[model samples]
Target: MKILNFHIRGKMAHFRRYYSNSSALSYSVPPRTTLIGLIAGLLGFERDSYYGDFDPEGCRVAVGVCSPQKKLVQTLNLLMIKSSNDLNGSRQHHSQTPTELIIPANIRTGFLDYEVWICHQNNDLINTLHTRLEQKYGYLTQGVSAALGTAQHLGWAESARIVEGEEVAEAQADFFSILPVSNVISLHLSESRHRLRLQKEDMPIHFHPDRTIAGKGNFLINASAAPVNAKVKTAVRLSDERFITWMED
Candidate 1:
């Protein structure tokens, strides 16, 4: 399978957890759904109209964090709307609610960079996306508008060259991408070497309402203080550095 590799970066990002209510929590990396939305935007697909175009059966996506990351929780005062019909009355009814927002610690100079791997059975779609990203013309003039969680936090991407990759037996490395817990052949944590930590999250992969389920699943993400030794099974190699597994059903 051929995979298109790309880089995404931003000063700050927040991938909100769906289950969080009052306090919005964020995922460490962009979920499969977020990736789909980004690609759809670049393709100029209407909102909620392109879910099937990038379904798991046809397209696979993987993401890896490329920078040191830290999480911080902050509160924002948000206005609550009670009635839209009564403008004068709505002001009296509206109240400022303090909402907790989970965001990346470095909101200014500290950039959140990620390596993305996208593999699709359709070669034309892949070529178009790559060409558009590289030229930065037509639909992808400013690059696709990407956000970690909310639309308020914006990011950009450029065309990343695709390269050949090889599979190795084992190596000590920090994982920057989300992987299926079942596909992980083996994992080793070293506090002195890698400072590795494990985080498990339930992420939504598909948004098509027609499906029996919305395509939600659990994913295991690796967080490392530094790179660690690991034995991984991956089908595609990215940038001669990272190995990525396909997002499967």
Candidate 2:
């Protein structure tokens, strides 16, 4: 299988958790649905229209954090506009609400980076995306215009390369990537590891506005810690230093 690899970074990112209502909590990494949205956006697809084009069985994706993880909580004051007639005959009223926002910490360069891998059986879409990335056209035209999580937070692709990788045994390393929980055949602590900590997050894999659930799925990832020598049954070595476990539906 052929894979397209690229790097994306942003000044700030907030991948809001769907369940968080009062507070805007964020996922440490971009979820599968978010990656799909990004690809759709690059291809100039309409909102909520391209979900069916890329099925989980045919299109596979993986993401890895390329920067140190840091986050901060901020409160944003949003104006709530209501449309109604009051007893005094007022047509509308505006109220302010303070909402909590979790955002990535800004660095000296003011960017947070991530590595993305995409594999699919459809050659047309893959080739188009690869061409766009290589030519630096379409969605890759402007870095800031390509939004990652929210429309307000824009991200840019730093570089892209097509890679044909080989499968290898999983070894001890700091997993900066998000892996599907179902693909994990075995996991263990590292030889030099003292504490074993893993962050399990459930993110949407598929989405449809008409659907009731909006296609949700679960993923397990290590935010920053290095897991003990773990062995994955299906792992691919993208390069001399980069390795990722495939995500399964």
Candidate 3:
């Protein structure tokens, strides 16, 4: 199978947690569902129209942090407008909402990078996506802009290419990408000597055609984009000597 490989980076990102309440929280990395949504956007699929086309059973996704990241919370003044007459803030009731955002750990770099790997059962779809991505990450040909979580926080993809991978036996190699929690047998936290940054997140994996979330997953990821020594299942070894765990349903 051929996989589309690319890295997305932006100044800031806020992938709000699925169950966030008044305080808008964010996930450290984009979940599988978010990756699928980005792929759909690149393919120019209409809103809520490509769930079935990219089902978990057919399309596989993996993500890895390529740059260090950190999150900060800021209070945003949200205007509460009930009707059209209140559009100009004539009747003002501003709610200070604490919003969390993900950014690069260092300010000088100015980009938070996330590497994405994806493959689909549909050969034509894969080819189409590879072509679009080659066209400057699809912005020119598709006229679709890429963003990290929201439109206000714009992002872009670079180095689009098709690469081959071999399915490896369980624990064949150490994983560099995010791994589903269920597939992790052990983590080598001590061997890393405090250099590895780990995080656990409950992320959405799949959605029904009707737009309801269908599957959720718990995953372990290295936030610093470093290698993690761990025994994991469903491993895939890329041609470039990188390993990843699939986001299975």
Judged by whole-model lDDT over C-alpha atoms, candidate 1 comes out at 0.66
TM-score, candidate 1, is: 0.79
The residue-by-residue lDDT of candidate 3 on 23-91, one tens digit each, is: 999999888888888888888888789998888888999888888888899998877889988778777
Ranking by lDDT: 3, 2, 1
- RMSD after Cα superposition, model 1: 4.0
Query: Per the 3 Å backbone cut-off, how many clashing residue pairs does candidate 1 have?
Result: 6
lDDT (0 to 1) per candidate = 0.66, 0.67, 0.83
Off by over 4 Å in 2: 81-106, 136-144, 167-176, 192-197, 209-215, 225-229, 239-241
Per residue, candidate 1 scores C-alpha lDDT tens digits across 1-249 of 567788877777778777877677778778888887887778778777777788898888887766767677666644455566654454453544333343334555667777788877788888887876676542363334766567777777765665555445433344556666655667766433545555777888877655333777776665442333455565444566755565552
Per-residue alpha-carbon lDDT of candidate 2 for residues 168-246, written as tens digits (9 for 90 to 100): 6644444446666775666665452544446778877776666334566677765443333455556776664566765
Best by TM-score: 3
Candidate 1, superposed: residue stretches over 4 Å from native:
80-108, 136-144, 165-176, 191-193, 210-213, 224-228, 232-234, 239-241
Clashes of each: 6, 2, 0
Greater-TM-score candidate between 2 and 3: 3
My TM-score estimates for the predictions, one after another, are 0.79, 0.78, 0.92
Candidate 3's C-alpha runs over 4 A off are 80-91, 136-138, 141-143
Model 2, residue pairs in steric clash: 189-228, 190-228
